[model samples]
Target chain A: MRTITKNGVRIDDTFAEAFPMRGTALILTGPNKRWARQAAVTMTGFATSVIGCGCEASIDGEVEARDTPDGRPGVRVLIFAMSSNDLQTQLVNRVGQCVLTSPGSACFSDLVAADALKVGDLLRYFGDGWQISKKFGNRHFWRVPVMDGEFLCEATTGFTKGAVGGGNLLICGADYEKTLRAAEAAVEAMNEVRDAIMPFPGGIVRSGSKVGSKYKALHASTNDAFCPSLRGMTKTALDDDIGCVLEIVIDGLTEAAVADATRAGLAAIIKLGPRNGARRVSAGNYGGKLGPFHFHLKDLLA
Target chain B: MTLVLTLKVTPPQRLDLSVLLPHLLADKSSKDVAAIDLATTREKITVGDLFRIRAGSAEEIRFEGGSERFDGVGQGLQQGRIFVAGDAGINAGRQMTGGDLVISGNVGPYAGSAMTGGRLEILGNAGDFLGAPREGELNGMSGGLLVLRGAAGRRAGDRLRRGTILIEGDAGDWLGSRLIAGTLIVLGRVGVSPGYLMRRGTIVLAKPPALASTFVDCGQFASSFPAVFGRFLLPESRGAARLFRAPLRKFAGDMAVLGKGEIFVPA
Candidate 1:
């Protein structure tokens, strides 16, 4: 493996492979910021990776009162799934359950993409026959009556056909705690990048996985190559000085966004330096055969 | 440059000015436009005989004067703008699918009748049957917006299937009567029996109306629609959204008909 030192941390000359995903955004607004954030958080809950959650989602950012449709504080959430059909189903189900139930919560579309899912159109049925549909200036919305007065939701939220997912940064250090600290710093920097979201818990993942497990039923298992405990038993990629490695996965609406986020993350980790955070920074890939988009670490740093 | 048409003489009878539509005259020269025959009930006069037509692009057509005998002022207009400096006769914007029709002075009966799309701005008062359908038609003003800065005559929004009508002035009796579905907001006081026979629609009045006994009061409603709807009316009200929002006392009415319509007056 090729490595270069930057900001006192070794940079591995590897790349992160990202696959295409269907991406969509939702603007959840409430009478107050607290409720708006609550609805957004509740809707994005348990949506870490698409493997088990069926989707990957997180809060993109916060919108001020003036920017939201209802003139209230709002939270923008992004969700990514494997297919357009899957994305439509996931968003409708999530918004119906989480955002609709939240007090004083309303939802709108944050994206103006060509392809859109009629999420509110389906959810308005909950109001029975009392639902009112309003259209103004080419935009349509539904007012569904609920216990908290009514839930105002846009008729549809747009989705994009080509989004980038699985862009990751693997931070290796002498120990677990320091490596985790490095991943956290990288995530903080990544969070500032627009059009990208880190959906993992605390924006950090300790269990990185490879393609397949030893068992026939499983399609994925642990990455033993980077595990410190499985050193000589398998083909190990870790050195004697490296005791733990952590990862931060990023999903973005565009390839350029993913690249920008990866650069910001790598720059933040390298800025932390070896003494305080990570000893080395690397990326995960499957020889780039699985995905069309590739982000080389050295290319990003340069 | 705007196409200017000045009335040279007062026609003896009602003249159909619908022939002056922008789309029809867009590619035509002044001479060609003037050559078009104008329909009249009592006289035969081409556009050239009735007006002094100035050669200009058809994107914006302006009438230097107005006449009560000019009927169907802006009909079947798909795009562009039509401006009338003075009073317009009946059916001022009949069946207009799109574009802007602005009348600086008062308009006669049947203003904006059967218009499907576009914006009609009347700076002065409107006569009877404003935004209503033709005599035999069942639906009127299917789409688009109409902002009237002055008062309106009787039977406004009659059988309106869809669209929005905003009158900043008072409305005569039988306002929004027989309205099927649409929004009609009158900022000033309204006469008796508003929302009469309306099956489904919203009629918001800034002042109280002489309501009919058939209408049932729905009491106070606490909904997000007022503020949400206020945002949509902001630009139409010169950016003063608060002027369009008021504590509304909703009355679900036209019980004499389908009984699904609602009228909102200031509480």
Candidate 2:
């Protein structure tokens, strides 16, 4: 494979390692955009990774009022987990606590066809016999009474198979400021890609990890191969002039989505060129031992 | 495509055509459809005797001529859609399970009685015991959606166990009387004794109705419950949707019974 270079930026001939994950999409609506967005943000908060929260979630996009079930301002959110059971647990807990508690907010499933999990069925207990169940079209919804009024939620949410999680792009630059700027631009561009979400804070992950740690009990540790501090002690993947590094982690409903987001992010960073300190773009993989989906950098941007 | 049944002559007495649902005739040919039995006042009669039948595979079945003497229009319907062109008699949709039933004109008593599932839309008025179960049965309209565009007679949604009934016009006395569990939304004026002996269910009244002595006012407050409930009504009518979006006065009552039923009036 031939490497592509734009100005001083090098596109590595590597691939991102992704594993199969279970996930579901939810639509949260409110009387207004502010309340809807607040509910969505709260539901996706503290959900950066399955390592800490047992799920990864983020606001995917905004929905038009006419398109929603209630003609209210709404947002689309996606949550992914390693297992379907874990995904369901996270979905019920987060929605029950965040969306059901939000004033004038309602939660709905975004999937049209798939195996469904009973999200609202489990949460309706909070209504304490006051709950009302409604069947509209082909879907069932629950109306749980609350202080703000009632929280309407779909009874079930659908999940699909072969969803890719943990695809990444490592941005290395000449200095901290330039590298960070390019990474920020890349994150912004990736956010526009459909069906994919960057789960880390601001869509950038600084503490990139490897499969194992020096401590026996740890499953993952810092990526010493790319760490600037460990460059002298370890066989570093970066060059001598590389001063700053940032990683963008992507999780998507499909491998194609992850690849598209990666290609978009790389193009956005490449557009910044050497002047912005974008030196090279690489990816993280565990020597083909990680997972099934592999998004090659060269083939993606080709 | 639609299966059209147009009456050729007026009937002297009531004709039980409840077997004329979409599910029964969807796959049948015109010749086969016309052979279906209809019990009239005089004797058992074939559908071809008094009406013309044009058949197709479409899920929609339309009755073209006036059917003032026709009864049990969609009884035991399991699937498909039904459209009645004119007035129909009693027991229009008894024990309906699934599908959509639309009546362009008025229907007599026991409309949507014991309906288990599906949607029934009455463009005109309905008679007594709308969505009510039969005398021997314990539940009425266990599941389904019943929308009445015009006024309803007494005892609307009586003993309803499940399902939703939306009345665009006024409801007569005993609205939702003895409701077991279900939702009855009256967009227009409601008559006396609304929610009487209700055990558990929801009654949304656009125009406040006179409550029984057993009820207790829960106080008027700003709420979003109506907005949520209103969304479900959007597909039925825009007026109904708007009726539920505003603040409402809620009353928990039918205290004479189990007392879990609630009535919400637009504030």
DockQ for every model comes to 0.51, 0.36
> lDDT, candidate 1, residue B4?
95
Candidate 2 lDDT over A20-116, as tens digits, reads 9987888899989999999999999999989989999998889999778777899999899999899889999999899988988989899765687
> Evaluated with TM-score, which candidate comes out highest?
1
Off by over 4 Å in 1: B238-240, B243-249
The deviation in Å at residue A69 for candidate 1 is 1.0
Worst 10 residues of 1 chain B by lDDT: B238-247
Model 1 pairs whose backbones collide? none
The C-alpha RMSD of each candidate to the native structure, in angstroms, is: 2.0, 2.3
Q: Please tell me which predicted candidate would have the highest lDDT against the true structure.
A: 1
Model 2, range B67-124, lDDT digits (tens) per residue?
A: 7688998888889888889998999888989988889999999999999888899999
Question: lDDT per prediction?
Answer: 0.87, 0.86
